[model samples]
Target: MTTSFLPQSPPAAEVRTAAGGHRTTVLIGTDTYPPDVNGAAYFTARLARGLVRRGVRVHVVCASPDGRPHTAERDGVVEHRLRSVPSLVHDSVRLALPVGVRGHLDRIMERLRPDTVHIQNHFLVGRMLAAAARARGVPVVATNHFMPENLFDYVHVPGPLRPHAARLAWRDLGAVLSRVDHVTTPTPAAARLLWEQGFARPVEPVSCGIDLARFRPVEGGDAQRGRIRARLGIPDRTTVVFVGRLDEEKRADELIRAVARTGADVQLVLAGHGAYRGRLEELAAAEGVADRVVFLGFVSHEDLPDVYRSADLFAIAGIAELQSIATLEAMASGLPVVAADAMALPHLVEEGGNGFLYRPGSARELAARVDEVVADGARRRAMGARSREMARAHRLEDSLARFERIYREVAAEGAAVPAGGFTAGR
Candidate 1:
């Protein structure tokens, strides 16, 4: 069972309330946004849209897509893009300059008077947003989606300085998050880790929600299978689909070798991109499964449902996941999963039920588990039924409702920055 810290809001502070049951205005802050494509970006965009649909006005503060404030809008939600420079190391990720960030946020909050502020990270933009919002007497709710390892995956730092770097990162994170009324992570494992690292503030576990309607089994799923075969050029073959960034930590190369070890006539379809893709291709060629493996980088969101529906089974080789959104999506599509036994993945894949959890880094074990599922039609369908059942608890509406309640409680509690400003914890 998971544990959560009760929200500890500041006492005797005024909160911005909706005017006589009018639409509440919400300001969401994040470093990443849509068209960038990552777990954090996708969830933030959806959250904003969900709030907007429920008769709320949402304003998003995120990195500028083109270094200009053309400002993106979706279904009555508006994104205020700040100036950003694309990372030289990571072409897809951009860092918004912090210069005048707090000033701009202060002005925005003062003018808009949003009822609550939700931030998605502790980086430059998010950090500034929390402080500015608190200063303006708005309740703040922050969600952390990355560990230090995940951050360094995209931004390089010296190997020897990592320990000190981690400490520094934690200090910065602690200081900023301390100011927020509440904090959330995607899973219990993640919440526990933060608490162990001296993040004494309130922490809650919220799943990264998936669109259950689109991802679930469609028309007995037979109609989707034929098209998948034609799209990937693999007719009458067992297919294991892995959808996520092809980064080193994701261990896509290891999955390929594991499939090769199985010695089954199975095809591996990878749907996502990262800096490590070249290395993955090289590894595939060396493993002699190059012909069977397909790298379909950056699959469109519209086509993602089909990709999941067409697969016979899904696999997650990565161990660093707090909660695998891809695993949930596959489960929703009525596909059994084979995930690495590490981090929070074990919480989702019940042994001998929906799928098996192989020891992390054990390619042979992973292959054996995956082959077991794909080898039998009856067994596969039974496991897939369990997967669908598991996915129901994580429906998008459930997560959205949880967040909605959090926002309302914090706002009603009237939490605000103390008179002397936030005090940093030791």
Candidate 2:
């Protein structure tokens, strides 16, 4: 069961700190990172870059394509790529654990002796990294990103078998989490979920920040709107945008159904790609709303701001989201959101304030909310303004500052019981 997968360890001395007395180095292990473009990847990338900005040297350990072992510095962050199995649908990869690589990681950690190890995913590589860090007496911090429900979509397990699968997954996760000095979740809802699953680690709730500068709305005459509309082939009348993976969990299909229910002359633009694209397309076609729905798969990072800006409103029905980064981005772009009032959605979407919330899975209610926004230009404008102001609070720097504080606190605490362990049903 034990095998070492790494080719050869890079010289231990090869790893060195860059400018600034940031002597603190953090190793972020995940199954995905930049060039992969998922939530986990985006979070890790931003966190790494943010730490770099604070003068902390960051080293990323992530899965890369086979035979493509490489090293590079991005935004002052160093990435050490390792081989992984390619995902079937998306341009994603899964990290392969090798016993040999664990030794390499141990050597790297011994030399770097990073102040802390931050793990973003609870995958095989992450577990191995956590164990390695523990063995080296390095402090560990883990960010819980994925929900157990997401795994059920990929595995062939039946609904009845989910509890067992979830229990096993959480048990293994608890093992990795117990060894860590601290754990963080994007939202309180996620933290609660962790607690319910029997994880006794201190779980802090901190969100990954949104970039206010890039996401703010632009002030322009009809000319700008006209240009954006022309480019998107959307009529200037009304348009609703859903920016996220078009997966069943995201409920893009639900949004489409809601839009169809509205029967309003509004275009529905579906952004992001996933395994459920074809099914969503089929649903849209069957619903006879195919002509009204536009599929814009995998938008470029640079174009995301404009995409949000071009939309008249943003809507999401996914109840499983810990915190919808897309919703945050949309709000940052000054777009009023119509989100499900379940899980973490209510925390962000304040009804009649910055955005509106419908009951989770209620296509009729979602449709009605969409109609409300579309009908009142003045109300939408007001909500959009509030959204911009609210977004300022969650800027990337602020979020990073919170994390930086946690890092310092955890490092100072030394060996002790995790402070924030969850009490059942708290």
Candidate 3:
């Protein structure tokens, strides 16, 4: 487990730079940001806001939501949105063209004079920003929130060729990450995955963490739950809620199938939107559980906690999670989990303890597991308590403190390094 650190006092009013400037700034680069509605974007936004709360000046460079350049301050962090085009594969995704990306990044680097550059992926925006930062002697810290499986649907990689595609993806990831000052993922299992993928550097696991204060067991909010359910158009029933993008890799269809197999008085509620929504709704109808499956598309972050509190339990069938922030949020809300036995999920679940894990693609197995937890009220409450206890270890404050430490260390080191010292290599 990653050790939790108490947050230090906010930094001094100002810090002197090598050029004798009086400010401490961090520039974060991501291919996506708010209104993008994905895990990486959510994490990056939270990270930026958290740093701002700790008295650090934060600037984010990311793709514009509407194909036009703009700058705005939100949640106490400055967002530098670059001109972008809609992705060919996804309706909601936008990608910045690489043709003149470096020039734009260079201008931003020169303007912000960021003390450190923290990148959230190895995609176009992050890769270009890292190069520009390195060229200017700004230390770059990268956090990996990627798995090739997550993109296979969008990229339309054939099933048989997925293995080769994954290999190429990992190699390309490693090449970019190798040039950075530090690398981190959200769990120890994810760190191991980087090593196995041939990334020749020490990787640290940092829990994306959650706001424990806000999401807690709503001990007796039956009225509140009903109100939330009514708002979401979810029928009042024993509900198994899954909160995430209804993406192909998430396998929400499995949840629909499993709910049908249970043949019980339960509904599966999905609270996000994606390309898979139409197909999933069709599958629910085909499985004869269309009425029992509710799609609460794109629930805002503010309402997400109530969404969790409205559930009887939380379930996920995704196979590519590094550390599922949604799962953590559900756990913090005191809901027991039913998850797929793959990736970093095992790190969060204790079989038959706080939750149960079933075979990744077996709807029958998943049905049985979900039934086992929901049938016995006493066991369910006990498991929910355990889930809450487990969630305490991943408080968002601890994550913020740990990241601040890393930023300070890397920034101090960056001050001494010569410009253009970092070069991409395996």
Task: Give me the displacement of residue 71 in model 2, in angstroms.
Answer: 2.4
Error of 1 at 297 (Å): 1.7
Model 2 agreement with the true structure over 1-426: per-residue lDDT tens digits: 101111122233444444454567778887777666557777788788767766667898877656365677776778877756666535344555463667767766787778788888877668878888878777788898877776676665689999878777777677667767888999888888888776766578989788786678856945686688777666675789988766666778888889789957887988777778899989999988898888878666566677787888899888788887888888898889899988888888778998789988788988999888888888889998888888787888888778777777777876343444333442
In order, candidate lDDTs are: 0.79, 0.76, 0.84
Per-candidate TM-score against the hidden true structure:
0.90, 0.90, 0.91
Candidate 1: where are CA atoms >4 Å away? 1-20, 158-160, 221-224, 231-235, 417-426
Candidate 3 stretches with Cα past 4 Å from truth are 1-23, 221-224, 415-426
Candidate 1 local lDDT, 1-426, one digit each (tens): 101111122122322234477777789999887666577887787787766655567899998978875576655678889998886646777878888788888888998898889999888888899888877778999998877776665657777877778777877777778778888999999888787777766689998776677688746455558776677454546779998887777888778988788856888888787778899888889988898788877666567777777688999988778888889889998989999888889888889999999988889999999889988889998999899999998887778778878888888988664332222453
Model 3 scores a C-alpha lDDT of 0.84
After superposition, the stretches of candidate 2 with alpha carbons farther than 4 Å from their true spots are 1-22, 87-91, 415-426
Model 3 C-alpha lDDT per residue in residues 131-217, reported as the tens digit of each score: 899899899999999999888988899999999898888878877887889888999999988877766678899999888977888
TM-score of 1: 0.90
Task: For model 2, state the Cα shift of residue 58 in Å.
Answer: 0.8
lDDT ranking, best first: 3, 1, 2
Give candidate 3's root-mean-square deviation (CA, Å): 5.5
